[model samples]
Structure formats: C-alpha cells, structure tokens
Target: MATASAVAAPPGEPVAAPAPVPELDLDRYLGTWYQLAAVPQHFNLACARDTRATYALDPQGNISVYNRCTTWANTVNDITGTATINDRETGAQLHVSFPGVPTQDRLDGPTNYIVTALGPDYSWALVTDPSRISGFVLSREPALDAQQWNRIRAAIETAGQNTCSYLTSPTTGGRGDIAPLCST
Candidate 1:
C-alpha cells in the first residue's frame, strides 16, 4: 500500500511565482522509477514507503505503467495504468490515471507533468503538474544517497517549490509520519 500526503495547492496562491518547466529528453524518460517523495494522495495511501513504478510502451502506442507498493502490514499492492502523449510535438506533457474503476474517465486534462529537470542517465526525475497541484521526486531506488538527494532538492528549489510544505515519508512505524522535509 502506498500512502500520500494532503494535496498541495498550486504555486503562487499565497505568494511566490509559479515553478518553471524544464526541457525534457523523452527518449531517456521511459523506464522504471521509485517514488521517493510525492505530494500524498488518497489513492496511494496504502503504500508503505518503498513504492515503485515501471513504464513501457504499449501496442496502442501509449506508455504502459505498473505501480507497486508495500503496506505497513507487509502486503503488496499493485496497479496498472496507461499514459498517452498529450502533444506529439512537444512530448513534454502527459496524462495518467489508474485502470481500476474503469468507468471513471482517465485524467486526460492537460497536466503540468513537465520534466523540469532530469539526470543525465535518467537516474533521477523531477515531475510536477502545471498547476503545481502535484509534484514528485523519483529515483531508481527506494533510498537515494545523500548527494543525489541534495541534487534533487536543489533542482526542486530551482524550480521554485515551497520546500516548507514538502513532507518526508517515514521508513518505519506509525500510520505514516508526515513532517516537513525542509524548513522555510
């Protein structure tokens, strides 16, 4: 079970400029990544920290996705979803949603999901929805080395994220510890 924190508001609500979208190399963007940190959501609440997602091409020309998360009780939960390019020309944006509850329309609206910054080898990725309603810090593994973590933090700051609201996922114990990862 993957857990998420409260949904965050878009940038500039109280104050501050919106975060900038960075150039993305789509070719290198396809693959698997561990959800190191995210603006928690209800759907993924069961996931116990070490959550991961894999992406691949589907026959219909969409990005096939597989997400897995471990629950506090040690149960494994997984979900499959598909993503399509919002615009073929830029290929910088996308729309993704779960396949469960099939009737619910896939969240196809234009999302900020911009690749603000990426590692040379795609080892790390910084993704955010345009409204800044959602953001994620992903890596190839559950635990990122200090250097990698710092690098990602710097990139988030560079993108104008209010680190004060960003919270860290607890590795063990409790319903899920929710505390600010950085100070204002």
Candidate 2:
C-alpha cells in the first residue's frame, strides 16, 4: 500500500475546499487521460506502461469507463467500468464498478470516488474519495511539460497529499529515458 504524511488541518474543522462543483460538464471531461501518477492500489498491479483511461456518457445516466495499460509481458490489458454520480448536489462525487460483475445489486455499495480538483479546461484532474482511500493524477497526454507538472504537484500538496508516496508507472523501453513515470 502507498503511504504519505497526513497534511495538517485544524482539529475538528473541515478543510475548506478550493472551489464548488458547478454542473459536471461530462462532455468536457470526456476523452483519454494518461495516468501521470497515482497512489498505488491493487487493481492496477499488472500495468507496466502507457496507462490511460477513456470516458464517455452512457445513455443510462452513467459514465462509461475504459482503462487500458501495457503489461510486463508486453501485452495490453483493458477493463471496463461504469460510474454514477454519488451526490447529485455536487455531481463531483461518484461510484465506479467494474464490468457490471456483481450485477446491479451492489452498485451503490463501497465503490467510492470523488473529483478533488479539475483544471479549467479539463486537461488535468486530481481525484480522491471521501475516505481518502484512493487518489490519482490524470492528464490529457502521456507526459506533461515542466510547467504543467509543477502546477499539478502544487495542487496535490494543497490537497494534503504526500507526494513521496506516488507510485509512477514504468514507461515502455522505446525511449532510452527512464524518466519517473510520474512525479509530484
């Protein structure tokens, strides 16, 4: 599991959010996002490089999720999931489940998700859940320029996240550079 130092906040007081959720413009947020960084989680262990996700609006008021990655074996693996807004009030919190596997019975169970921060153009995003159990850094491309990266790092820090714990994915060997897959 990934670990990070907890950000200091006033005791018994909720941390003030930087902004409020306007209606979630799903259309703007759609398309592919490269996994620039993430707090390690079990589900993506096999992913080696070129990790990305694509989203689309489904007719049933759900967000369709498609995650793909290059595995250590040089094979590609993909998984599909569906996400629904958990809070209509903000439309920023959501729950995502894989492949409709457990059917609809457990759809609303423990699949926690939240959009902690989003860039004005939807080019970048910081996602976390209510329990702070999951977090991710997503971008519109496989890599970001130095300036964009700095902004992302600053946002993560502001969100009370420990940058050191981010586990970057490995890049494919095509380029001789072994840049850190993700950086804070």
Candidate 3:
C-alpha cells in the first residue's frame, strides 16, 4: 500500500522529499500553536521560553503569521509574516514570507512550509521545509505527554528526519528535562 512518495530507499541512499499531508483545512489550522520542539534556527536563537505562533486569515485571503517568544533577556520578540498556499489541491504546501527578516522572505519561490503530519483532531502537527533543513513540532497545548512525544518522534522518522536535531522548546508547563526530541 506504499505510494511512490512513501517508498523507502536502499540502505545508505538518500530518501525522497518529504510528503505533505493529503489535505489541510485552513480554518482548522488557523490558531495558536505552541512550539514543542524544533530544529535550531538562527532566528529562534534568542528564544528562551513560550515560543508560539498564531495564524489568521488576512484580508487578501493569505494566512497571517504571528510568531512570538520570550527572549533570554526577558523581552518579548514578535514578528509578523504571511503565508500563501502553493498547492491549492492539498493546501498543505505553502510559501511563507517575513518582511525585513534575513533570508526568510521567499514567497516567489517554491513552497517551503509543508505540513508533513497532523493529529487527527488538529491538536498537533509536524512542519518542515522542502529541503528538510528546518522542522517544528507544534501542538495546541504547551506540552505533550510521553505518548504524544512518541507519536511525534514516529512522525519525524516517517518524514526522513533525524529526531536528534529537534531540541525541546521551553514552555511554562513543559517538561522539566528539556532535551532532543529523540530523548524526550
């Protein structure tokens, strides 16, 4: 029952590009999502705790992206961006652009924000770029239990990513032992 995109490569060979979810409902996805874990990125370097993103529909029918985090210096860092659906059929592939952010704006290029996995109730999700360089584990709650962590890890492996690279994000009600996604 494996599709072409789900076919695994032979040992030592590169895996195919990550496949996005079959479909996405914009209304269901437009809400605040707490960062449970993420592949380290320069823009998020200063984030200390409570990293979350809020998405809403904009006037032009694009997704409005609002990301905020408490910095190590105890100040709040907030940024706004926009997301455009590149794959209208599935609505799971998108191009996100942040004005004035270094190297983040790429609305003109191929889709980078791809939702590879999502919880049945839309309570959790796995997001990654086409290159598979950046990844994020997002949830409706600030933290997930052990069972939820295991599910997220399985989804990460299914997407051909290394769980070791995903470091836990600190949140008020999160796990005390913050570590890599594989160890959580």
Q: Evaluated with TM-score, which candidate comes out highest? A: 3
Residue 29, candidate 1: Cα error in Å is: 1.9
TM-score of each: 0.74, 0.78, 0.90
- Which 10-residue span in candidate 1 carries the lowest summed lDDT? 1-10
User: lDDT tens digits, residues 84-172, model 3?
Assistant: 99998999999899988767676555788999999989999999987788999999998787777788888888887888889999898
Candidate 2, residues 45-110, lDDT tens digits: the string is 787777888999888878888999988798999988888877777777778888545543355654
Cand. 1 Cα-lDDT: 0.65
Which is better, 1 or 3, measured by TM-score? 3
Candidate 1 C-alpha lDDT tens digits along 66-102: 8888886899888888777775655767777665545
Native RMSD of candidate 2 (Å): 4.4
**How big is the positional error of residue 8 in model 1, measured in Å on the Cα after superposition?**
15
Model 2 accuracy (lDDT, Cα):
0.68
Clashes of 1: 12
The most accurate candidate by lDDT is: 3
